[model samples]
Target: MTDEHDWAPDACTLPTAERPLRLAEFDRLFRDAVRDTDRPSPRRLRLRLDDAAEPVVRDLIARESACCSFFTFDLIRPEGDALTLDIRVPPAQVDVLDALARRAAPAPRP
Candidate 1:
């Protein structure tokens, strides 16, 4: 996987030092939590996850918030066994989120 922080602007919102590690963590959390995902708009992606995945998802988002201030995360739980993570970024930074989403994709069966 590419080091996302490398291509992100110099003024990136996330702390630089631990970006690689954080990205790895994100991949793991997403692999475990993601049930469905789609781009809801040009600048936003909605990730639906199993309700039981909430704790890990919440923790990951909380840690991500500390370094990436530009991300807008909304956790939505409806009357079901699923939760939604609405992630938004600046229009120009949509690609950044795309890269993350790609990383979150589950490995294909061999």
Candidate 2:
């Protein structure tokens, strides 16, 4: 992730000391479970995750929602061994979403 506070918006209720821990949690999910990412709109982001990650995904999103009410997370389990997570933010928080998308992106191959 860029920085602990980079993607966090002013509306977030998470305490300063805990921001890095939360960011690390998100980074871990993106690195280990995220299979794909898509941007259907400026204010929305979609992540395809391994089906086995459902429990962790659920727990993470629930905690995230508690702290960041501006984020609207929708978890969908379609057929097959995959789960889709759609994240939406209001217009004012699009920048935060953008930062999250960047963080979720796969690292370049050397």
Candidate 3:
């Protein structure tokens, strides 16, 4: 069970015209594309993906930021091949971010 107070702001907050697709759909695809995750500290997380996914990831981040203004995202492209998405948030929002990280983590192999 969950209360309104316990809920995080979701895609519903955005205007219907602005949301081409639901957040859950984007998150599902995003999680599948994520290759790695690193948590340097309690307040920050770094998610890595191959170059091919960068454009979609960038679009996703843009939409996510519009709905969830509390989070700060930095996209870094290294010299080699991967793209890193660094996300930071206030301590109170860490739980929300953690949930996102958990969702984004790659599925385990059989």
Q: Estimate each model's TM-score.
A: 0.79, 0.91, 0.77
Looking at model 3, which ten-residue stretch has the lowest summed lDDT?
Answer: 1-10
Q: How many backbone clashes does candidate 1 have?
A: 0
Q: If candidate 3 were superposed on the true structure by all CA atoms, what would the RMSD be?
A: 3.9
Deviation in Å, model 2, residue 10 alpha carbon:
1.0
Better of 2 and 3 by TM-score: 2
Leading candidate by TM-score: 2
* Candidate 2 per-residue lDDT over residues 36-101, each given as its tens digit: 999999999999997888999999999999999989999998776369999999999988988999
lDDT of candidate 1 vs native?
0.75
Candidate 3 matches the true fold with a TM-score of 0.77
Off by over 4 Å in 1: 1-9, 13-15, 107-110
lDDT of 1 at 86: 89
lDDT of each: 0.75, 0.89, 0.72
The clash count for each model shown is: 0, 0, 0
For candidate 3, give the lDDT of residue 63.
78
Ranked by lDDT from best down, the candidates are 2, 1, 3
- Choose 1 or 2, whichever is better by lDDT: 2
Error of 1 at 91 (Å): 1.3
| Best model number under lDDT | 2
